[model samples]
Target: MELEAKGICFRYMSKTAPILNNVDFTLKEGDKLALVGPSGCGKSTLAKILAGYIRPSGGTVLLDGKPLPDQGYSPVQMIYQHPELAVNPRWKMSKIAHECWTPNDELLKDMGIEKEWMSRWPTELSGGELQRFCVVRALGPETRFLICDEITTMLDVITQAQLWQTILDIAEKNKLGMIVVTHNNYLADKVCDRVIKLTDINHI
Candidate 1:
């Protein structure tokens, strides 16, 4: 999926401060972009806007060169810091995985999650395990772009490395475009093809 944001600006009604100011960028298929900024610098907000979750107070977000469309082909997906929150507790692991089902039944197993774990509840899984599923679910067919918002922040360094490798492999294998939202400069440099500093935009 191709994405473009031009002169985007936004501010919360609850606060007088503006979060994003005249931000602009683009992500083409298989392009990996890292958004870096200090806390409260609008990284997550911009990610949400790009994912079509929040409407910008000004400017526009276009997906595939067209204005935002409702119920589109699930062209974009998000992997949040906490995967369990993204997964439903009442739903079985299989149901959660079904949200973005793939023909490769061995993918999760290859990620070190056993096939039997698919039957367990998300709450029963470890943080790292749940995160692997989150990547799996988002990378499944029908998803073309991913907004990864500090997805590995909660995992241990080892787990973070493993998960990052998995996500990178999947993105490369599928030629998926990705927007990596994070404050971790190291991870950003390691994962993204280009880095955009939102704090600099805030000053412009």
Candidate 2:
């Protein structure tokens, strides 16, 4: 499978300048691509478009030459930089984690998710701990592409390394396509097979 973004354009408001213009890229199974650019360069905006979080003003995001599904579980899943904002505050960690699918024990272990934490609320966990759940939740078997938008930016080096290792292992095992958006060049080099600069593709 392949995820392709073609001629994508986006703007926050009609009166404001476009944030992304004519951005394009493709990611296929087993393909790990890093998107790098300065902050506010629309790297995150493009990632959202690809993940079906927002509609592009003037283009298409296709999965395997067809439009992404509008209903049911999307083959594309995105893990955000802030896990707290992504989950529901009213639910426990177990409910949030199982909202999509019940991740196996082995997967949870690899992600360093404690079984005890599952009974607690999001507010009870540290940022690093919350992020582990976010990562595992996005790795369901149906996910064919994963968009990671600076997902480990708030963590320490040790936690970041552990999370990345688990993510890479899971992606490889599932043959999932990955788009990693970040400003960290070292991280891009370490995790991606190829890199695309947002400025190079976005004309805004």
Candidate 3:
């Protein structure tokens, strides 16, 4: 794993609302880290920084003790709160899954999703199914780390629990590092090895 951020700073263009200031953290292999804070506290911003989606105004982000790439996404992938929004409307579920991994009908069935659903469009599937596919997509080739941004926010409690367990199991099996960003402390306790409160980070 080996992720770290030193003296990070970020601000939005809308206002001087400094989202992150001098944020510092480290995540090693098999680390299940949770970033928790109130909305607008910059938890998501920091997550973006970790994933190399956004650059910090100051400081550095490293992976395996080396600075992360400047352009293009990191090997790290993200699972968002809404899977439907993440998938393309025109592509069939099978296509989406294939883009992530070789088609394995057995795996789909084991995920409690029928193989027949593979031919269906994103809009044809239920929310949970869509999200399951979204997770699969992010777990595709080259993915070593996952930045889960409140991924279960759009699901029901039962679905959330099931998905969380599945994700944790997958991460452990694959030795994948994860940074889970959520405001829900309870969920954090259930999923993360250690939790950090974003509000505690200092700024310049």
Best by lDDT: 2
TM-score of each: 0.91, 0.98, 0.88
lDDT of 1: 0.83
The candidate that achieves the highest TM-score relative to the unseen native structure: 2
Model 2 residue 124 distance off true place after TM-score fit, in angstroms: 0.2
In candidate 1, list every pair of residues with a backbone clash: none
lDDT tens string, model 3, 49-130?
Answer: 8888888877888888788876553577888777888898999988888775673555455456777888899999988888
Worst 10 residues of 1 by lDDT: 100-109
How far in Å is the alpha carbon of 171 misplaced in model 2?
0.6
Model 2, 95-166: lDDT tens per residue? 999999989999999889999999999999999999999998899999999999999999999999999999
Relative to the true structure, candidate 2 reaches a TM of 0.98
Q: Using TM-score as the measure, what is the rank order of every candidate, best first? A: 2, 1, 3
Candidate scoring better on TM-score of 1 and 3: 1
Between candidates 2 and 3, the lDDT winner: 2
lDDT by residue (85-130, candidate 1, tens digit) is 8888898877777776663766776666677888999889988788
Backbone clashes in candidate 1 total 0
Q: Which stretches of candidate 1 lie over 4 Å from their true place?
A: none
The count of backbone overlaps in candidate 2 is: 0
State each model's CA lDDT, in order. Answer: 0.83, 0.93, 0.80
